[model samples]
Target: MYSLTLEQDNRATVSAAIHSDRLVVACLCAAWCGTCGSYRTSFETLASKHPDMVFLWVDIEDHADIVGDLDVDNFPTLLIQRHDTVAFFGTMLPDPAVADRMIQSIAELPDAELQRQAQSTAERRTWQSECNLRQLLNAPG
Candidate 1:
């Protein structure tokens, strides 16, 4: 499946999937970004290749509440997570190959390893506290 844009229906899909064993790969971008526009096809193709993963296109401007105060200096920031463990979260180059590789590598890691790496780095620990999609998307109103 292609990367689903955030909407009411898709939000439910993501909400349920995040708690499952599936890997969640989200690209945080804005509609006005040229790079993001060009990169959309590549991102979808990557998603098609990995059907087991849940890929999302989150427009920060449109979904600011879900995004909250997350730091997004660049156009295409990536947030890769499985359950409560945020495997990766940061700005990425617009290249789809890089994202594909990252997803493959992270998916291969054992849950314990992911949990370790999540807290292993200061940056990653920050992701756990600040950039977690599970927490951000499911926050109480």
Candidate 2:
């Protein structure tokens, strides 16, 4: 499975992927962050394990237009979404195992429950607005 590293040249591919029905797993990082660089391999490995999902590596500084409004307080922040629902969005540890487990647990949840949680709290609702990859990609500049 190929993991997409979002860049100016690949914006079209990333945008296309975001419009799909599959779950999107995005790693929000910065190009200059050492931790983010070190964690890239692990993130790709995790993506390899999940062939059905769409994995994206987004450099916050490089693609500021897409993720500038997102409050990514730490390196390697994660955003997981499916369709219009932002299932999870927060700072994640650098450990790939933790990410794997979190993905598994979230993917296991019923769609109805996930949709409910997407709107159950204000923070989660904010994800719908700020962390939705499709919305960000399609947003007007």
Candidate 3:
């Protein structure tokens, strides 16, 4: 897993990853959250286990413009996407094992099925529009 910290200076790195066609696993967190602080190490460890994916640590407060429309009501929210489709977006448990399992399951799904689920419901469709990192990164500021 290639983990990258998202900051103003590194936006280009993230942009490059978005264009790479690999799975993007982003952990949306805040600097002030204790749980997030503790989970950071685990997140990195998880990242190391999946070297093919791109893991991003995005602080909601720090990068408000990029994630402004996202309603992250809890700590350690996760946004997993492949290409332009958001496969999963929501608050996750602080457990790394759970996250690892979830990632594996989602990654195993066929592209056609993932696309079907992305637009199968209102919330899922919203993820496609709002939680897609590729679109967000490309959107005009």
Candidate 4:
């Protein structure tokens, strides 16, 4: 598993995985949120199931420099991506089953399809521009 719990000590390694071609499933949360705390275990189990992909646990407060502009209005937001396409980005229910289903559904779509959807609607368009994780990771810190 190219999986990582993002932290200051391993920024470069996690950044490299984010830049890779593999599907990136990032759970954007805050350490202080009770819901986030409860959801942590499920997120890890999900990561273990998808060893082929890169699963990242991002504490928004800890990695604000990268995910701050994400405008997270809720706890346990999910950023699902494939290459340059931001397939899905939004607050998901804290249900691991739902998150797992999402990973499968999104990862099944082709990049061209994902890109098309990103531009298909106003909300999705915003995601393409604002929620692109790779772009966020590449931003100057």
| Residue lDDT tens for model 2, 1-141 | 757989788888988987887788999998899999999999999999998899999989988998999999998899999887899889999999999999998888889999998999999988888788898988887
Candidate 1 residue lDDT tens string, 1-141: 635788765777767777667899999999999999998888899999999888888989988989959999897899999888899888899988888899999999999998999999798899899988888888975
lDDT of 1 at 97: 88
Candidate 4 structure quality by residue, lDDT tens digits, 1-141: 667888889888887998888899999999999999999999989988998899999999988898887889897999998887788888999999999998998888887888888789998888888898878877888
Give the TM-score of each candidate. Answer: 0.93, 0.96, 0.97, 0.94
Q: Judged by lDDT, which candidate is best?
A: 3
Q: What is the RMSD of candidate 3?
A: 0.8
Candidate 2 residue 4 Cα shift, in angstroms, is 0.4
Clashing pairs in 3: 1-50, 1-51
Q: How far in Å is the alpha carbon of 17 misplaced in model 1?
A: 2.4
- Candidate 3 lDDT over 6-125, as tens digits, reads 999989889998778788899999999999999999999999999988999999999988998898989899999988889999999999999999999888988898899899999999
Worst 10 residues of 2 by lDDT: 1-10
TM-score of 4: 0.94
Tally clashes: model 1: 0
lDDT of 1 at 80: 92
Quote model 2's TM-score. Answer: 0.96
Quickly count the clashes in candidate 2. Answer: 0
- For model 1, the stretches where C-alpha displacement exceeds 4 angstroms are 8-10
lDDT score at residue 112, model 4, on the 0-100 scale: 81
Off by over 4 Å in 4: none
